[model samples]
Target: MRFDQQFLEDIRNRVSLSDVVGRRVTWDRRKSQPGKGDFWACCPFHSEKSPSFHVDERRNRYKCFGCGESGDHFKFLMETEGLSFPEAVEELASSAGISLPAPDPQAAFKAAKRNSLTDICEMAVRYFQQVLQSPAGRSAQEYVQRRGLSAETLSEFQFGFAPPGRDNLKTALLAKDVTEAELVEVGLLIKPEDGRPSYDRFRNRLMIPIHDERGRAVAFGGRTMDPDGQPKYLNSPETPIFHKGTMLFNVHRARKPAFDAGQAIVVEGYMDAIALSQVGIKGTVASLGTAFTEDQILRLWKFSDEPVICFDGDVAGISAAHRAVDRILPALTSGKSFQFAFLPDGQDPDDVINAGGVSAMYAEIERALPLSEVVWQRETSQARIDTPERKAALEKAVEDLVGTIKDERIQKRYRMDLRLKLSNLFYEESRRNRGPAQKGGGGGGWRNNKQGGDEDRASTARMEAPDTPAYGVERSFCTMCLMFPELFERHFERISQLTYSNELHSMFMTALVRIATDLAEGTVTQIYNKLDERFYKILQEAIVSSRPDEDSSKASTLQRWDTLTNRLQILKEDPPEDFVEHLFLNYADMLELRMLEMELEHETRAMEENLTEESWSRFQALKQDLTRRREDCLRDEQELAERGTKMKLNKAAMRG
Candidate 1:
C-alpha cells in the first residue's frame, strides 16, 4: 500500500531518530566526537573490537564505518531484523502514532506483524533487565556502580545484563511463548551462514535498551564487563524501527526542558548530556557520530532560537565548531542563531564537573560567543593587516561573510557596525602615525588655534568666546568647575557669591564649591561623591558632551578632568587667552542680574493686583535690587569691552 508523501513526512517528524537508535545502541560516550553531535557504539554487525559505528540522530540515519553499512530506520529494520519493506514502514507508522490507511488489507496485516516484532523486542528487554538483577548479573551491576551511575538513572535508562551462555535469551523468551524463528528474525539469536543452529546473540554483556522517542524499546546496546572482552561495547543491529543519524541522545527527555529554558545545548556524547542534566542543566543532547548537519540545526531551532554548540578546546573541537558555524550561516534566518562554547584544553563536560562541580561547566557555557561575534573574530583576528591591501582584504572578507545573511535588515546592520569598526581601526592607526601633536592642550581654544594654524591663538580665543548674558551660563560655569576643580581655587570666592535660578543648578554649584574647598587636591571623584545624585548625572552628561577630539586619547585622570572642564569653559566664553578668566566672572554676574530682573517682575505683578502694604514693600525692594544689578552688569560689560580693545591694540603694536 502506497502512503501519501505528507503522511510519511509527518510520521517521520513525529518519531525522533534518537528514540529508535537509542533502543538498539548503548551510547559509548568515550568514542563520541566533541562538538560534532556524533554518537558512537561498537558495530552490531560483523563486530570486532573497537567502535566504528555512528548514529546521527539529528539526520535520522545510522552508519557503520567498519562494515560500510548506512541507512534510515526502515532500511535498518529490513536488513537486520529480517522485516520486509512494508513491515518496516508499518512498524515505524505504529510507533509514530500514525494510523494506517483505511480499507487497506495489506497495511493491517503488516501493522499486526510489526506489532508482534515490537513485542518480541520489548519482551527481550524485560528478560535482559531481570537477568541483570540476578546473581549472574553481579559484574554488570558493579560496572554500572563504578561508572558512577545512580541506581535510579540506571533503571531510568533501562540497564540490564545478558548472562553468559549461548541459549540464555533463547530459553528465557521461548518460555514466554516467543518462537525460535521470531527470535532469529529479530537478531536476538544467531544463525550462522554455514547453517549452525541459532543461539543467543548477546552473552555476558551489560545491556542497555534503546528506546524510541515514544520510549519503546526497539534495540539493545551491550557493554562487556570483562577487561579482556574482545568488543568492549556492542549495539543492536539496525532494526525496523532504529536509525542512528536521525536522533540525539536524551533529546526525548531534554526537549521540553530545553524549550522552557529558551535554549538547547549540543554536547559531544550521551554521558555529557546526561551529566549536564544531573547537574540541573536539562536541555542537553549529543549528536550521533557526525558533524552537525542542517537537519540537526533545524531540529534544535524547534526547541530554541539559539542552541549553544559546546566542543572541546582541542584543535579538532575548534574545527568542528567553526564548521558548524559556517554551515549555519547560509541557512541563517531572522531570530535564529547559534552560539559556540569551547571547553578548556584537555577537558570535556565531565572533566569540568569533576574539577569544579557543575558551576564550572556552566561557566564554560556562559562564555559561549554569539554567531556574529564568532564570525567577526574568526575573520579579523586571523587576518594580516600590516599593509593597506591586507586591511582592505580583511574588510572585504568581513563584508563577504556578512553579505551571506539573507535578511536585508540584518545584513544592513552588520555592514554598518563592521564599517564603523573598520573606520575606527584605521583612524587610530593614522593618529598613531601622526604622534604627540594630536593630543589636546593649551588654555582655552589656544591649543586648537596653534594646531589648526588658522587665526593667531590670541585672536581665535577672542573670536570664539561670546559676550551674551545667556541663560544656563551658571550651569556651564558650575559644570566646568566640577570637572576641573583646580580652576576653582582662584575663583572659589567669586563662585561662592553666585546664585542660581534653577534649583538643580544651585544645588550642583553649591556642592562643587564645598567639595573643592574640602579636598586640597580637588578630584572629580571627590566632587562626584558630594553631589546630589541628579547633579552627578548632569556632570557625567557634561563630560560626555565636552570635548570630542580629546576623548580618543588615553589621558591621565587629572588631564582628563581638566580637558573636560576646559572644553566646556571654552564653549561658554569667547575671549582672548588673557580674558578667559574675566569672561567666566562676567558670565556669573550676568546670571545673577537676570535672576534679579525676573524676581523684580514677579513682585511688581503681585503689587499691581493686590496693592497690599506687604506686596508694595516687596516690589519696591526687588525694583531697587534689579536697578543696582543692571547698572553693575553694564559697568562690567563696558570694562570687558575696553580691556579687549586694549589687548588687541597691544597685540597689533607688538606685531608692528
Candidate 2:
C-alpha cells in the first residue's frame, strides 16, 4: 500500500535521520564532521574497521563508501531490517506520529508516474557521465582539468558533458525507450512554438546533475564551454520534479560538510561553490542565479543557523546581498539568520583561491557581516544624514525595516540598538559643529597665570596639557588605527583630511591611509610588503609609545586595539558617544594649535628684529591667540585628569 506524498513528507520532516540511525549505529565522534550532523560508522551490511559510512542528518540521507550503498531512512530500514517497503513505511510513520491513509488507485498511479520520472532522471545522468569520457568530450575534459579539478573530484561529483550535436542526447534517450515527450517534460529537450523541430536545450555544455535530498537526480545545471556563450550557465527549466526557487545548488552534496564545520556558505554561482569545495572548505552551496528565497534560506538553516551568503565584492554583488537580506529578514528566528560574505572586488571564490589559497578565502569568510550590522549599514551607507529632516527620515526608514521582523523580542532589541546608533551619530556631529573650546579642548583657567618669557611660557604650556604628549600623541592614534583597521573603515576620510604637524606625523598618517585602503580591499599583505624599513620603525615606535612596557612582538592586534579604546574611554568626563571621532577631533585640534604657536614664534622673532607697527600688531594678535589656545588646552587636560581620577577611585571602591 502506498502512502500520500504529503504524509511521507510529514514523516520525513518529523523524524530525524540521526535519531533513527544512531539507535543502530555506533557513532564515532572523531570520524564525524564537527557540528555537521554527520554520524559516521562502519557499513551495517558488512562489518569492517575504519568507518566509511556516513549518515547526514541534515539531508536525511546515508551513504556507504565501502559497500556502495546509499539512501534515506526508508531505504536504510528496508535493507537493514530486511523488511518490505510498505512495512518500512508503516514503522517510520508510527515513529514520526504520522497516520497514513489507506491505499487508493490514484495514489498507486501517481506513485508509479513519480518512479518513472525518477528513473528517467537517473538514466539521463548516467548517459551524460558516459559521454564525458568519450573523444567528443575532450574540450569538456580540458575545461574541468583547467579549473584544477582532479579525476577523483570529477568522478565523485559525476561531472559530465553534452556534445554540440543537437540530436545526440535526444536519440540516445529515445533509444532507451525514454519517449520524446518524457525528454521535453524533464526539460532536456526544448519544444518550439514555431513549426521548427524540438532540439536539445543544453548543448555543448558541462552538465552537473542536481540531486534531491534523497540523493536522486532531479535536474541539471549546465555551463557553456564557449567563451562567447550567451548564457554562461543554464539550469533545467522548472519541471514537475524540480522547483528552481526552492532548490539550492549543490545543497545535497554540501549538507553533511556544512553541518560538520558548523557553517554553511551560499555562494553566487555553482563554480564559486565548487571552487571553495576543492580547497577543503566543504559544505558550500550556490543560489540558482536568483535572489535567495525564504524557502531556500530556511533550508540552509537546517545545516547551520547563520549560513554565510557569499557574493562578489562589486556594486552588483553588494546590491544582490542587500536584496538577499530583505528576503531573509522577515523569516529570521531568534537563533537562525544569515551572514553576508563579500569576496574582494571583481573576485569570486576561484579568484581568491588563486591569489591566496584556502586560508585567505577563509579569512574573507571570517569578515562576513552579521544580519544586524548588514541592516544598519545598508540603510545608512546609501545617503548622508546631515540635517534634522534627513535624520528623521533615516530613523523612520530603520523603523519600517525593523517593523518587518516578526519576533517581538528581536524587533524591540533591534529598535533599541538602532536608536542608540542614531543617537551616537548625531551626538558626534553636534560635537564636531560646536566651537573649539566647548568641543573638549582646554580646561585650565586664565586666573592662575605664571610669569615667564614668550618661549619659556610656550614650553610651560606644553607641560600643562600632558594627556596629548606631542611627541607620541600622533603615533598613538595611528597605532590604534593600524591595530584595529575597522577604525579606519569609519574614519579614513576624516584622517585623510588631517594636516600633520611634523615629518614623522605626515609619514605615519600616509602609511595609515595606504594600509586602510588595502585592508578594505582584502589585500593588506600586498601593501604591507611594499612598505619601506622606515615604516616598520614608525610602527614599532607607535606601539611602544602607547604602552612603554608593552612587548611589541608578543602583543596581539586585538589587545593593542582594546588598550587604545580603554584609554579613550577614560580620557574625558562623559566621553563622546563616538570615540573614534572624538580622537580624530582631538588630533585636528592639536594640529591647529601647533600652527598657531608657530605663527606666534615667527612674530616674536620679527618684533625683535624690527619693532615696526605691523610686526607689533601681528605679535599682539599672535600672543593673544596663543594665550587663549594654551588656556583651552590646559582646560581639556584638567577635565581628562579629573575623569581619570574619578574612574580610578570608582574602580577602587568597587574592589573594596
Among the numbered candidates, top TM-score falls to 2
Top candidate on lDDT is 2
> TM-score, each model?
0.46, 0.57
Worst 10 residues of 2 by lDDT: 440-449
Report the lDDT tens digits of candidate 2 across residue range 1-656.
75677777788789988777776678887888737887898666443546988988778789989667799878876554434578678889999877778668887787677678878988888888999999988999999988898787787678899889788899989999989888898889999989688899889999988876656788888999899996999999888888889888777678767765568999988888878888777888888877878878777876776889898989999899989888888888765778887777899899898888787888787667667767876876654566867767777788789889987756655654455345434443444467543242111111121232122222211211223346456655665555434455556676786666546557867865765444323222234445553454444332232322112343333233223443454532323223334455565556567778777888888778889988888888888887887787777666545655766687556334
Q: For candidate 1, lDDT tens digit of each residue in 1-656? A: 77777876776678865566666566788877535657888755433346777878667678988667787777765544334466668899999888876747887787677778879989988888898899988998888777667877777777788999989899888899999988877668887889888888789998776665556676676767778986765766656665665566676677667765666999976666767877778888887556777777776776776889998978888777777777787677655789888788788887898889876887677667667656655665455555777767776777778777777655644554444334334433443356665421121221122343221111212211233445346556665564333355556787787777666667867765665445334322323434454453344434333333321232232232213344443442223323555556677778777767777888877777778988888888888887888888789778767766766666456334
Candidate 1 regions with alpha-carbon error over 4 angstroms: 1-121, 162-207, 218-240, 380-656
lDDT per prediction? 0.65, 0.69
TM-score of 2: 0.57
The CA lDDT at 323 in model 1 is: 77
